[model samples]
Target chain A: MSDNITKGKMIKPENLVYTKSRVMTDNVTSYCPGCGHGTAHRIIAEVIEEMDIQSEIIGVAPVGCSVLMYDFLDLDIQQAAHGRAPAVATAIKRLMPEKFVFTYQDDGDLAAIGTAETIHACNRGENIMIVFINNGIYGMTGGQMAPTTLEGMKSSTSPYGRDVATMGNPLKMTDIVATLPGTYYVTRQSVQKPANVRKTKKAIRKALEYQKLNRGTCFIEIVSNCPSGWKMTPVESNKWMEDTMFPYYPLGDFKVPEED
Target chain B: MERELRLMKGNEAIAEAAIRAGADGYFGYPITPQSEVLEYLTMEKPHERTGMIILQAESEVAAINMVYGGAACGKKVMTSSSSPGISLKQEGITYIAGAELPCLIVNVVRGGPGLGTIQPAQSDYFQATKGGGHGDYKLIVLAPASVQEMADFVELAFDLAFKYRNPAMILSDGAIGQMMEKVWLKPQKERSREFPEWATTGKTPDRERNIITSLNLDPNKQEDFNHKLQAKYREIEKNEVLYEEFQCDDAEYLFVAYGTSARVCQKAIELAREEGIKVGLLRPITLFPFPTVIISRLADQVKGILTVEMSAGQMVEDVRLAVNGKIPVEHWGRMGGIVPTPEEAVENLKSKIIGG
Candidate 1:
């Protein structure tokens, strides 16, 4: 087998490796270079295409940069008010139970202004998916400190670093939502490397597949990187995130329905 | 079959009419006076009858956003709340208006300013007629003085909301919301078979995906959209100004009122006539358009206009603007949930207008 293989050679047409997801348009993403939102969008679009759910899915885009998710994703999308995607998704899923509804929200939109909606939706077990991108800072509004910003982290709003006593501790919202009985699947993942990206894609597919079970809410939080907001190069931000953010916001499944 | 008549509270009538009008969803929170609306919907279980979604939202803010969601999908959706609750919903309402999404909002107002009282008040008139939330926008406001109008306005509100692709509000008060009266419920109308092409229902390949949003970052584009909305509002004002004239023929004095105050003013007008004041009532059914043309015409015929309200002179400002200084315009109101009686209104008119 080794002798028959040629190194650094182009494969045959039938052996073509990877291609863009059909559900994703050719339009370039609005996300900055090296930002994790683009990878997250690709993961979702790929999952929607692989699952053949492009036609039956409606996405709720948040007020942050991902508000234009419809531009890149071919699925029908509704733009929700800041932090109101869960409430919007609840209605979309309820009114059309057969449709696959999901909300793409940021840490600021999901854990800060929308905390009530996020918690209540999970508590009610709305049969919809919520994709939360936690970048530890608000990127769209120019590096403002988010609720998920780690203690001692410096951002535009927290120029003197986050004072845990005064600014409050970093909110572990995934842990909180996982505790809600209405949630069927709750997991935290990241996409900093090729291996992590593959894992995140699998998690998204699992969430979409869980929708067929008519289970309760499925929440997937991606601990993403915002290089510009963090005042670091893409490589430096990933290294810093791996060294700092992963310890506080560890990546793993917090809750999942037991196998029968 | 003959239409069945049943005694229902104004809040209950709203819930029943929403179901009968083929509303797709009711998202609401429990508040004083208007809690009956949510309670009735939950208890009646319209989901079984017509597959209408009834969700008791965590807060008024969430309820209105849910309505925004359903409406964006081209579903006839509604939410009901009292004054304080409606205040919480203003953010979502503004978003819905900016998106031009069609939905119905019922505000059964109580004494406000700040949790003033749970009693009936028309203080929300300014908030409703003018834009309640931040934006250049208008909500088609319908004032239902009777339980029948409460029932009837459900369909009308949905119709007008979809007609203009704008939010419509039923500005009721605590008195009408809690009071029981006979209402002839309309038969269940079928939901429209033709969905809006702009709705964000899951995209089919035949058309492009729809986006419901209010985010126009470019100032110039936002300004142009604002101008377009103002033109739509102008058309609405031209076409949808509704009012009823009660004994306006040859009357020397006119009473301007709406909602519960309109009912009270009707009685006051009768008493004023008996006392030889030659008074009539101009009850505005659509408060947003303000019935300005009718009030302008009546201003020419009447010597003076006395506007009665349950608030501290809110609608009176609109009445004066409509009068355009052609005649004397005065405001008489009992604030903080103090509903003036017919005798008090008549006495106020006599002392304030006739004596002056």
Candidate 2:
């Protein structure tokens, strides 16, 4: 920040086009390069700043690569057990209804191990936001095959490639949850492009706003890329995510509340 | 100074006591021998009275994680389940304990190795007191022998849990949970709105962000935290050992027991005294603290001790450890949902300690 000013650029606060949100901490992120987690974190932080809800929100970080979310976000957080973030957020919102609560979970955490918690929390219409990152593979535990793994996608556990007959069909959590009546707003967004990042931020802001209405659950599935886990460079992974990941996990709004 | 006197099952008493104790929330899944707890809370409509939140989670795993959330907020929250359900909650329980969050867990134990029976058993002694989960952690385990104690211990468990920032458990069983007894409940306490310093409420201008988690990637820091937890456990051991002595003043032999078996041992003590036998009972109320000091002292005075329980000698291992080979310590009991009758208890005591 000082370099921009000290480098004789003299970037005034009023002249600045963009800066890191105060809702984010100075702690360095641990996510791998080209991973969507860092952008997703900053976007949520920016949304919190924009909504002025930094002091009124609680975040639950699921057991996955994003388990250290508390280290980066400048807000209160509870790290939940694998696949238990929804259940944890449910109790928080129920006990302190005035406070905003959300869970940041990954594909393996949300779709596989914590499927019951995810389904039930959404089914019960829990008034919280669920930010799911569907990379379609377990990144933290060395690229294991997740429930959302695309057919023919090769994971470490499924080195022979995901066999649709034995592995069953890829789980489309956003689509499934959108069909549930308990969900008020459900969308699938990605950050491979700048326009998509802005869309995801808007969805986050909208979800956080909708939570105050106590209508029902708001879920966002961010189709993400895992560069290191996918054995590809940042550029290659982005292209691969577009070429392979997007065909199955399309980016668009699947559910929205009726106009009031 | 007025008391709310009522005749209720131990499970019902626990539910009522939690409501009266000004608990912030109760998240639980229904399970046998303890389902009455959730049923009573739902039926009483405590939400209308104290504004406490009560939720029936989809499963025991969800129920316990819900408690983890409430505990993270530094609220008085609890859950109740049977043996099988409690087993399912082990992962969450360990996380809560490791995070050093305060919460209450009530285990109305039914028999189990693998969904064994709906009848009572003390088989979970090793699980509850010895830490059922995969980490080195301890819960303040309170053994409630009757409905009155069940009512009383709920508040006590929450108090100790918050005092030390640790999880606490009320270990009851099918017999006590099913039987009705008269209990004098305490007056209602006002719910606390003031958040604890460590609570993960929102990060205000006055404080840094509060993070409730057990994930420490650094080995040295994790070891230091473990040492700190051990220090807290040692402090709890020093202050929270609770046990009762019955006719142990001039006794030559002792029957060491807890929970349902403690009541059976009391009756057995009376029968043994009727035959001019100098036998007495020592009932441990706090199973985790284990009443080691008193038992060790009694080991010097008594000739022998017959440890009894509904399970096949789980608590006897602790008793033998407490006795420390000072005197003859033996275990006798029946398993597979069988609660040892007073006659059977007395015969086992005589044969296990006095004769055989």
Predicted candidate 1 versus true structure: per-residue lDDT over A204-243, tens digit per residue: 8888889877998999999999999998899998999899
Error of 1 at A44 (Å): 0.5
Task: Give the poorly placed runs of model 1, Cα more than 4 Å off.
Answer: A1-15
Candidate 1 has a DockQ of: 0.80
| lDDT per residue (tens digit) for residues A43-70 in model 2 | 9999999989888999999989999999
Per-candidate interface DockQ score? 0.80, 0.90
Q: What lDDT tens digits, residue by residue, belong to model 1 across residues B1-356?
A: 13569999999999999999999999999999799999999999998888899999999999999999999999999999999999999999999999999999999999988888999998998899899999789999999999999999999999999999999999999999999999999887766656788988787888877878898878999999999999999999999999999999979988888888889999998888887889999999999877998899999998988899998898889888888899988889888877789999998888777776
What residue pairs clash in candidate 2, if any at all? none
| Model 2: per-residue Cα lDDT at residue B49 | 86
